[model samples]
Target: MSLAEAPFVGNASARRVHGFAAGSTALLVGDPADGSHLAEAVAELGLVPQSVSGGSAGDVLARLAREAAALATSGAAVPLTVFAADLRVSAVALLDLVDRPSARTSVAIAGPHEIAKDPSAFTLIRVERTQRLVHSVGSARHVVSAPNALAVGALLVAPEDVPAAAQLWAAAADDPWVDPALDPFDLALVALVRGGVSVSSVPLGPYDVRRGAGVTVGAAGSPWQQRLYGASRGDDGFFSTFAVRPLSRRLTAFGLAHGWSPNVVTVTSLGLGVLAALLTATESRAAWVAAAVLLLSALVVDCVDGEIARFSRRFSALGAWLDAVGDRVKEYALLAAVAWVSVRRGEPAWLLATTAMALTTMRHLEDGAYMDRTATSRSHLVPDRLDLGPARDLGPADAPTSLPGAVSRRASAVSWAKRVAHMPIAERYLVLALGLLTGSTQVVLWAITLTVAGALVWSQGGRTVKALLGSDGYERDARRVDGRWSDLDHETDLGPLARGAGRIAPLPFTASVVGVGMVAVCAWFIDTGRLPRVAVVLAVLAALVVGAGCRPSIEHRLGWQVPAALWGAESLLVLGVAATLPGGGQWCAYAYLAAVAWHRYDVLYRLRDTGSPSASWVTAVTLGVDGRWVLLAFLVATGASMQSALAWAAVLLTLVYGAESAAHWRAWLGREGALRSEVARREAEV
Candidate 1:
């Protein structure tokens, strides 16, 4: 029989069911006297509660196994969270810690005072510096004198681990180290450890627990709001932290008070950004000042959207995707506007503009590629994993007991310096604003290019070190360009010639550099009536770089970043060639490339999040990167009307990509149930 049809003997029922929007069930097994109150609180938090108080851990597990099996048929992945009656953990801490996307099977660590009050009632957990659990012990008395490990209580079993957890609980009774005095909470902790569960510990902080009362939620106080305001993303630059974010927090509060969704705020920001770009294109002093104001305002609102999402705890793939896309569109639109204003002033700002865009795109590509490639490796933040014997009190009183604590302390000291070196979006945008205020598009573009180039060198140097140092997940197979890679969509259009040429090199860095060199030479000679020859070289180079058939691989540590750089170089060449054309085709080129960049970014974000890029047909319609270069080379060489051709291409690309991207996101939102379920679940927890 199917799991849904299976019989369950457990005395489990939804004691208090909220809306189906918050349909997940929380299994409660704690002090029998506190069961009803706990159930009520949990229900109020939008979870269905099932109390199974006063049972051996094995007994509770047997029932859980049966019920969990039956519930599996429903297809909603609901975790089983076991709460300890005496643990006064707030919902904010619990959700933030346990509900993270990367979180594994986890247990809450009891505070020192709680462990001191009743040492026997908890399981001592010792972990390596990487926070990987190394040892755990529990009994009626102390397992080891003056244990150098944190005490573990409460357990959260992820959906996939529920069955294994049940089996482990049942087998715990047979273990020689099992203590008869252990309660369900302690027993479950021991069972999970002894069963070799890769458990992580969440240390309870002062804010996580109440002083005297039971569960004084931090979110209700002003201090919690302050904490949220200060919880900036690690990569946030100095200007963002000192100016944008502080202003954003007040706007975030206003947004929340007005019941505005994060997406609404994002749209508002996008509108402001578009307006700023339009004003910048006017090339007047008054317009420049207004544009700067609008751009800065847009940045502040951009921050507010994210802050609202974090503070309200309403998150979704759509919101994240929109925010990312909006940023790119705003930045690029403003960049093109800057170029337009410069050309009108009889200044040769095209080169500077293209250079700036290319550098910025390259930086973003590296950031995305390196981050995605090393995400798993960086999660632990350690070069080596230590698997030492049982932890003991071996050092002097002042010596540090936790290696992670020491690492964190050291890292905090250098974090500000590192952020300054990165020169993030806030700094880049500020530079543009400052240059505009000075009424010099050429100066601003040059400044942006130089700053970005320097930042890229710093950032890429660090990434190269990490990749070469044999970081976890930076192995050969992981770095290989495969179907998971979206940057080289042109490969599919190239056929076997491209494939063979790619295999000859197989290193993306080599291909990217060579392709870029070929394009640069083409751009240089295009104005000298060598367009046909340049187009031929471009075709051959494109074929070699985007070789199809074979699974081309980049053996180098920095291979994944090559595709992005190559793509940016291609865009630079396109813009450069258009600037030299007659009848002001540069604007048309910018519009075309902007549409093209949007599609590429769509492919990028989709691949990052969903493991699938845009459809192959879409690539064909847009002429892929290879096709676009060949066509542009042909048109310029044939003396065709460059303006009309570019304008049409821009219109066509915009319509196709815009429609397809919208359809895809709309479909994705529907499949995800518009994030209603997640919103409901997190609302109560936050």
Candidate 2:
């Protein structure tokens, strides 16, 4: 038999009772303690009491409903009872079984105190129609129970003095347990349960206990969980949101209008540099002024191009590479013009040598360290990562994604220097004015070129070095796998120079050599009638000794032996020139100047063209040693001469030309060397 058919038993004098009959059940509801006592009294009746905790509102309702339904459907001819201590459960879940046609369910309210506290509770029980099993057996006028002594006592009281149950209920409503302020829905549910209304078993409308707390109770099959905590989510949306700014917008617009491609700007700057050099070679003040303007304009354009590319989001690797290469070329051209001027002025050799060394060092430092194609090689001035936080928060909706957020701070020294160089035109023009006041227009031009060239060199050089060698010294973490210093063989061809002397134009080349020969012959012509023949011999010997001694690798191998020989030779030339007549003296000076210029040009060109160690050696010697000595000599000579002003002018011009020429000649030599090597190897193999 089903458990619902089980028998029920309880004390006859108890405030409540329960039993089961065929297809029906009865429930006696009352105070919880009294209900338990009644159940114990029913031990002889063969019924067991089972209690379940009603921890939450939902739990309580569900429990009440299940117990009520089982009792209503039982087929056994027995009675079962359910007792609840409180009306916490809603009326619906408790009374759902009353509608069943196959069973009868009854509810009876016990305990006078309980009935008075909640009059509606009593009304709900009275409305239900299964067998009423009221232990009190009270009439509407005067309620009575198994012990009638109390009722008889109440019946003797004066009618007007009789305490109404409503008054007791009103007083009890003040009690916390009989909360009158309970939610209306909860109150209604309690009333239905008490009234024994058969509730239809509609599924619980989604349980939402956390609704008042503003917490969403997600459905079992919902995707909210995935959205809140999921992997493989991209940050594209975040970055795009960050990229919107007024400055960025303005820069982008300007970039588009200016047609300022980074690479184009770089190449243009290089062309301007070449033009500047060519103009400077004319030795005219107007030409110098023009060259200065062109150089300045080129620099301005160069600065704008990068700014445009960065702001407009059009930056590219090739453009950056070209910009770097172009800067080197520009410097070379400008300096080469200065060197050509030195050749015309007959300056001493040491000045050119110093300039060459300085340029080479600066360029190498920049190229090797800053732009070495490795992250480690990149300069510390620029950050490896871009800072996109501000942009992300305020960027346009459709901005490009995948932007990094670790931009270099703008306060780096290199950045500051660049800003200074690219300041407003007014400031730069002011600098130009100052240069003009301090020196000749030509001097100002050289100064301007040198200043710009120096600034560029420092900026790029520092950056390149940092890039090649990481701040932390981690070789494996280098950015480029195949940089300039990498072990892999990466030979660069120097184009036309590699074809050798055969391919060179006969007239111009021959003219240059012939010019040197003529100058030498002129030296002999001046020497015969002026100073002694011995002095002439000594001067020629000095040129040979000093020129050959300047080669570093050879000197290093030969120790100080070459230097001593050159010193002896120079002593003789100085004594010989001092003793010569004025006419011969000039010619002697001119001769020595020619020899120095020719030797310098030849050494630089050969080294650059052939990639010979000797070329580098010569360059180092001339720039570091000979160049400084020549400057000193010019200073001394000017200080002692009656034509000091002329001498000074001559010296300044010589310094400018010597420095520039040495640099260009070296570059040419390097290029030529590579070209020659390529042609020789190719031809020999063929």
lDDT of 1 by residue, 47-67 (tens): 576865555545654555565
**Candidate 2: tens digits of C-alpha lDDT, residues 183-282:** 2223222323223232211111111111111122222221211111111111112111132122233333344454545566668767886787687668
Q: For model 2, where is the 10-residue window of minimal lDDT?
A: 148-157
Off by over 4 Å in 1: 1-43, 46-78, 95-154, 179-206, 210-235, 376-403, 406-413, 465-473, 477-516, 527-535, 545-556, 582-585, 641-644, 673-686
User: For this target, which candidate reaches the highest lDDT against the unseen true structure?
Assistant: 1
What value of lDDT does candidate 2 attain over all alpha carbons?
0.33
Q: What lDDT is reached at residue 380 by model 2?
A: 23
lDDT score for residue 208 of model 2:
15
- Count of backbone collisions within predicted model 1: 3
User: What RMSD value applies to candidate 1?
Assistant: 8.3
Off by over 4 Å in 2: 1-255, 258-264, 315-318, 348-361, 370-686
**TM-score between candidate 1 and the true structure:** 0.75
